[model samples]
Target: MFFKEVVASLYAWDLLDENVDHALDVLQRETRTNSTYLVALMHDEKRPLTDFYYPHNPRRKVYWTEDSRAYWRPSPDGYERIKPRLSDSDELAGTDWMQVLIDASRARGMSVGAELSHTWIDKERTRTELADCVQRDVYGNPFDGQVCFNNPDVRAYAKALYVDLAANYDIDYVMTCVRGFNPGRGEGADTELGRLVGTTHGGCFCDSCQARAEAHGVDWAALTERLRWLADGYDRFNHKQNFELRLLLASTANITSLLVELPELYAFLKFRADSLTEFFAEVRTAVKDVSPRTDLRLNHYAGHPELMGLDLRSVAKQLDSIRSSDYAEQSGDPARMEWKRGYLHNIRRTVGLDMYFLSAVSPRPKATPELVEQGVRISAECGADALTIGHYDGSWLDCLRAVKSGLDKVGIEIRPDLPMWQRAAPALDGNPPHEIVPSSRS
Candidate 1:
């Protein structure tokens, strides 16, 4: 499938004012992509009033509203335990972007995909109205931006959203993005000690998660002790004078010794992975029950999925596809492509699932048309089953065009006029030329 991440605000900017059909046609013509998906809720805390490039259409105002609210109106029967704050912007008062996309897609005989960022929530409202759904760390401190997935109420809320989408809209895919735990102070977080304690990231150590862990034969008390120790050690390591010398052992002897002394940490990681797999299973079953054809896809953080409680090899069974961004263009680091290739290949080799390589296109100076083209070529070379370009804005026109050039160079053809089901390629069979690397638990 050739997919594009569309910003719904573009519709309010008059992209769809001429009609959804015209808008989708413009998207297809510009990007040569077959299918498009947008986030169910606004995740960006703020958006620029205009893109880095100028708009070709004089009527279209290039901008995104700075609001963390749902782009779609919640169904009266859909939300029960917890509800999302729907956007009440005057510009979007009557427009239901999801319904528009679904209707437009159905008219074109194309499949609709609904994406949900599980951790993206209304922080202000959550702090008061839905405080119970907030996630807590191992230290029992509440954090914003993410809700406790283990919380029965949050679980019910998520399941309901998926089921509702499957039952109400003619959506063929439900994609999810659940982020990893924050490591430490951004600059000094590369140490092994930080990753060792990452299991405590927005950790859902509430009563429910604790009881569930104990029920699954994991010693909750021992795990907590180990986590607290690792966290403390990381803090001390940060303050050490010989931090540079200690870095040599941080990944080798220090982590190895800690792991040997703390076997419960392994159990804790497995338990976290299990919890995520189980959550997806329930969602899969519920969605399938409602619409048997709907498939579940994960927006995987390829860098460290384990930190997010997802060992892809374990959770792969519950998912039909894995979509992750390639960091080559974003980082302007050619070396990142090595890991990008390994991550894509390993997913195919280990998980045996279809992979969608997401490439960023714009935001100038950093992401050039050449860089975007290189990403596309690399993704194809790495045996990615599909391509997903994140985030189409007016300024990304040149970069969007580069995708077609990249596809041509890679010997792939694009039929943007056709539906994805008709034009999407079959899943790849084997990994590219690379040995699989172990996803570190430390």
Candidate 2:
């Protein structure tokens, strides 16, 4: 299989291929790389994602994770899931858009996976933290590593949500859940923490986190003391006003090296490592019980671990390993000046960027020839199987072709481990227009 050979896969290509046929058309047009796999998503109240017409459409089945909160809303069409709510349907809504995509993508020969939306907590079940992994809610209220492992209610809930979809709807993989996103910047806070007008977003101070840590063999009180130590005299640093420009200068390596090597810190802040492992195992086992041949992958951002109380590398090693999302704006696009700098070289996912793509960064000049090459080559050398050049609502220009050409030469040839390779060390383009936020790891 194409996926078994390639170390990675890029989920989207050119933003074309609405469904199966469109994808097949691309495969027919190209020489077709054997090392890549396509990840197909389902769309509801929209076009069928099938008609996948490529040689390397999607090797796996399907599942869908969409933005749940309006703050995360990509655009007008983002809120289709659980929308219009449910009526007389015996099993929730009739095969959600996720099911549609999974069914169609499989028909087109793609691997489907779901990172279910945020709002859909098992209707009859209570949202409780399991004695497990660390995933926090919008309020920074930590969630016990998901309940799929030890809690039968959770396991059964997940099974019901997905199993029916797989058989009745024809999907292949379900990503279980999107790691709970802790909206530290106060997307919905009535208090000072919510305002985040200019304060540190010391994330997740919840009771469940304390309990989950205990279940996972953590010394909770000791960990709390360590956190206090880490935050000593730091309440003065306002997340807004007191933010320092120099923190941006701190190298990602300086910040990343810490979390990659230390699992204890993950346990201390996040609850427990074993619980996460068992949680992922449960997801896989549960999916397998229904679709024995399907692949399961848990979602986690490449560089967000340490900053967000997550251990991404550990999660990567724990799950099946597929790179998720990377959003950035390039100098070629006019909007490039709008976004601050966000790079992904330091991530170990650089080693397994299976099924991924680039999104946002539009307005032409923003998708600069320089930025495109840098981003794509970074993806390839880091072992990305395929790459997606993204644009919102069809705003892409020729930057993709320009970057692709350069990639044929110096792009994938560099080694990620070497310092020289990371930058080739370019100087600032003089008086950059935007003041991008520096690494959160600092």
Q: Which of the numbered candidates is closest to the native, going by highest TM-score?
A: 1
User: How many backbone clashes are present in model 2?
Assistant: 46
Compose the digit string of candidate 1's lDDT tens values, residues 305-344: 6665666775666666667654455555667657667776
| TM-score (C-alpha) between model 1 and the true structure | 0.80
Pairs that collide in candidate 1 are: none
CA shift of 301, model 1, Å: 2.9
Give the Cα error of residue 395 in candidate 2, in Å: 4.4
Write one digit per residue (lDDT tens) for candidate 2, span 199-295.
Answer: 1234444455455445545565654554443333234463532233124223243334443443333444343333344444455555556665554
Candidate 2, poorest ten consecutive residues by summed lDDT: 418-427
Every model: Cα RMSD to truth: 6.6, 13.7
Q: Would you estimate the TM-scores of all the predictions?
A: 0.80, 0.50
* Candidate 2: residue 234 Cα off by (Å): 5.8
Distance from true location, Cα of 285 in model 1, Å: 0.4
